[model samples]
Target: MIRPDGFDAVVVGSGPNGLVAAVTMAEAGRRVLLVEAADRFGGGLRTEELTLPGFRHDVCATVLALAVASPAFRALRLDQPVAGHGPPPVEWAHAPIAAAHPLDKQPAVLVHRDLERTAGELGQDSAAWRATVGAAARAGDPLVDTLLAPLSLPRAPLGAARFGALAALPATVLGRTLFRTERGRAVLAGMAAHSMLDLRSPITSGYGLMLAALAHHVGWPVAVGGSQSVADALVARLVANGGEVVGGWAVRDLQELPPARLVLLDLTPRQVLAVAGDRLPPRYRRRLSRFRYGPGVFKLDWALSGPVPWSDPSVSRAGTVHLGGTLDEIALSEAEVAAGRHPARPYVLLTQPTVADPTRAPASRHVLWAYCHVPNGSGRDMTEAIEAQIERFAPGFRDLVLARHALGPADLEARNANLVGGDIGGGEASLSQFARRPRYSPHPWATPVPGLYICSASTPPGGGAHGMGGWQAARLALRRDRQA
Candidate 1:
């Protein structure tokens, strides 16, 4: 039976952003309803025994670097202890090193939490490495706050300006101009590849700088049990603050929902159009249609008999590994995907969660999570290419796999409807797309229909598991509610 009493606000979808929005609104004394299509609450925060029963794997996002640094998450106090949960709010465990970028002939470049240690390992380019990443790290939370929030006049304008000037250059230009050694260049290239754009594209340097700085600011850590623990923490906080979540309720249309003063959508533009296209103005609909998506990702989960035997033993010390020989190789691979082709030796991002969090796997066993860029919606399987790349770095990597599960573009989209064509970063992170997102407007979150707003990763600070988009939209909704 449908309840006649409508909520003060209804948040569609229960991703990190949606959960944050619901929590924010509920905390403000509003009766909120958080809805999800899946049986689970977390969107990308799911964990499953995909390959084997004993080994647990993160289905999507594994790292919590961005989550910890996000203003929205910080405001919610997710790092603190919750009443019901055994661990503190999102218990995190870090490896000795944050990330390792391995090359063919030289020692792998390791990114340690300590900036000086990371720089010292770069050999000839140590000074240049420190000047760029170390300098950004020194700027610290103020710099992070400026980058994570919506595009606006920053509180620390000088720091923002300095960071912006350097961040605007192409990753290729930054690598070639600033560093001479493959060690430093590979590290920066690995970071930039996270943007899923061509390394030559403008503002690609920003991705590299931001990720590198994050490594120093907060080491890339995983939730104690799995990524789901992060979501569980958020849910615990939300429930404590009076928000309620209804799982397995797939909202097909906005009109079908119970009456509410505000509706926050955690969906991307495509899904939003399907649900509320008729109500939206023609101009807004067109803008949403124009919202471009980037390259897709081909992911893999492996139940390993043992740890990946890296040629460089130090590579095992890090939680995440970037496997592609050098800067030029990674650039070529990324460029191939952007041009709608798959590289034979694709650049791969692999995370061995068990290294830091032992609870993820049974004793003497390990779990490996990895993915590589593929052309959007491409049906071709790149498991062979990906495994081959890992094998290149860790000679007998394939031998350690007791079982493996692969998700191509279609599989990824099927699991999470928001991952349109498997383009994971909400939408393309291009300079034009970054500024305009769905469209160029002062209030990007607001729609033509009153009381409706978009709070997906497609908004400002696009992509990653950060909850800023939902937080920004909810804050806006609250302001409008006060005005009403």
Candidate 2:
């Protein structure tokens, strides 16, 4: 059944990485075939009706802040109308407030799209906030281009140098030492906590600082309908460039694939070890096996009768909310998970898309999804703890739930094998892993297996929806093909 001579290249696993790889090859005049194991195309970008009918929910990632800020996506110009393709299908929706971190005894700390406005509310921490997060925002695309390609020579060395000055520090240390205000420290803690690492872990501050910068520079946004629109748009771009997508076709082995000059696997090390089994050299296989995974997550999605009744009304206008109180509280919660125990009060990263795009639910109703870090592969249900954290900030939150869906680590893995025990960032973003991700090389995407490349988040500049990993991999493949 295989047309062995039809395609010049094949990309397995239809994630952001794989999709981007296919698009890049096809655009460069290669006959490309993109394959997915799932019935759908998007990996983390998928959307589904998880609850009652008509109440749509993002199955995975919702926020497109990185996508907006990404140099890879910027080159695609998805916002602009292509010459023959007409206007792009994707349009971003923005909430009044980008993010909020609510506290028990005070008004929530809000991050507005306007930098000065966000800093103005921080009182004594205003200038310090501007000096760090503001400076990152001002550095903008040049710095983002450099940061997204971690192993490459810095395009903006001055900006990169400035960033490294603060990035190497732990979030806990940076928060306590750099900023004096509790509001400033607490907000940074909330952003850094997204890394799913111990708050005291090195380079945790980088995650927090970058997120805060994105909020100011791009303003956190989601797609108009659901995040799936993003996947649709990317697919449209691919099809326009003559790439064919074959969905629901799982690639079990290299032998199953049609003959192609190049094969790009958008998979983590675990899947790579399985699919490319015995084909890889013993030493390379061992390195793939040795790749460590990070913390898992417990996810909850709710169809609400009405908007969350946040005690602080301002929080209701925010697209995203961090629900673990102060800097100390968040640090402890993340540390508990890092130490292999679930915190009684887990740090909940909640997003209310209806705040920005109400089309997700029935009229006057709303849809909400949240997840909290857990020990890797842990099966424990965190429904009660997650809801309690939500209730802590938004009173009467439980009453608003028309229906709810909960998925533990195992459930996430069942739905998407790439999740691999629900370590969604693809693998640990630890200091050592950051330096030598899945085995370091000048070209991390290229596997020892000639004509094959690995282009998942497991490589350098790990995780997030930015497609730099795939873009970089495809570019390298093109270069290699030219040389060959």
Candidate 3:
């Protein structure tokens, strides 16, 4: 039984963005309703015991670097501890090291919270590392603020210009030109590979630099319990602010729901077309149909008997680990995936939550979350390849796995509709796509359908757990409502 009235604004999804949009509208004194297709509220933020009881695993996103730095999240005070949640605070647990990239013949390259410390570990490329990642790190939150929003004249012009100059180059070119040692290049390359773009692509360095800067700005933190705790906190705040959330309710048609003054859809382009295709103009529909999606991911979760036995001891301290070896190796692996081929040694991004927050698993046991890039809509099982890559850096890793759960591209899509073809970044984060996501309207969130808007990761500041897209869209809706 669906409510037929008394809502000023309606949000179509309940992901971080959707939750943010609903909360924003509710805080603005608007009667808001948040609808979710899934049984759970969080889209990427959901956590589950995929392997065994008590061993919690983040279903999609694990790290909270971007979320911690998000202006929208900060404004909502989500990082603070709520009165009822717990005493330890449902905020975040910063790992000792942000991330560690392990190699076969040398010590692991660790991204420390201290910029100088990280650069000092780079050997011959220390000066260059200081100039690039170190400088961005010093820029801090201002740099993150600029990158996390739509492209505009930055408030910190000097820092933005410095970041832009380096960000303009391809990761491969920048890595080769600046770093003399493989360790330095590998460290940066591992960060860049998160883009899901080829290393040779222009502006790939931007992703690398942004991620590294975030590592220093706010160490990659995880929720106190699991990612679900973050969602629970957001939902609690939303409800506290007078918003309503309805789960297990999919909106196939926009008109099916109660009439509202504004509708903010936390959905991708393809989904928009499905729900409101008849309401949109022919030209707008055409633009959405042509929207591009990037490579997919093959995700795996494990309930381990013991910790991953890494050859490098530092690897155990870090929350996140990049398993691909050298700069060239990661570049080759990313290139292969983009070209629709799974590499024999794929780059694996692994997160050990139990290392930082022990609540995720039982005593002396561990939970491992890892994923590797694959072609869009790929059904191939890369379990063997992924395990082999992990074993390359961490010996006896397989022996520790008590149970494992794997999700291919299709499985990811089945679990969450927003992850089209398993692309967790909403859509492709290519330079061209960044400029015109879905379509090139001046107000990207506002659809041509009068009161409808798209506020998912498909909008500006493309992906991540950051709720900027929803926050921006909610602001737009409020502005439009005032005018109306």
**lDDT values for all models:** 0.89, 0.90, 0.89
lDDT of 1 at 193: 94
* Model 1 stretches astray by more than 4 angstroms: 1-3, 84-88
Q: In candidate 3, list every pair of residues with a backbone clash.
A: none
Q: After superposition on all CA atoms, what RMSD does each candidate show versus the true structure?
A: 1.3, 1.4, 1.5
> Distance from true position, residue 315, model 1, in Å?
0.3
lDDT of 1 at 483: 99
Q: Model 1, 1-484: lDDT tens per residue? A: 4447998999999888898899899889998888899998889989888998988999999988998888888788877877764446678899888999988877788999999998887889999988888888888878888898857557567877877888999999999999998778888999999999999999999999999999998779898889898888878877777777788898899988888999999999999999997999998999999999999999999999998999999999899999887899999999999999999999999998999998999998999989999999999998999999998889988888999999998998998899988988899999999999778987788888999999999898789888988998999999998999
lDDT string, candidate 3, 111-225, tens digits = 9888889888888988998898888888877777887775555767888888989998899999999889999889889999999999999889999988988888778999978
Pick by lDDT: which candidate is best?
Answer: 2
Residue 111 error, candidate 3, Å: 0.7
- TM-score of candidate 1 on Cα atoms, chains taken together: 0.98
Question: Which residue runs of candidate 3 sit more than 4 Å off their true CA positions?
Answer: 1-3, 81-89
Worst 10 residues of 3 by lDDT: 81-90
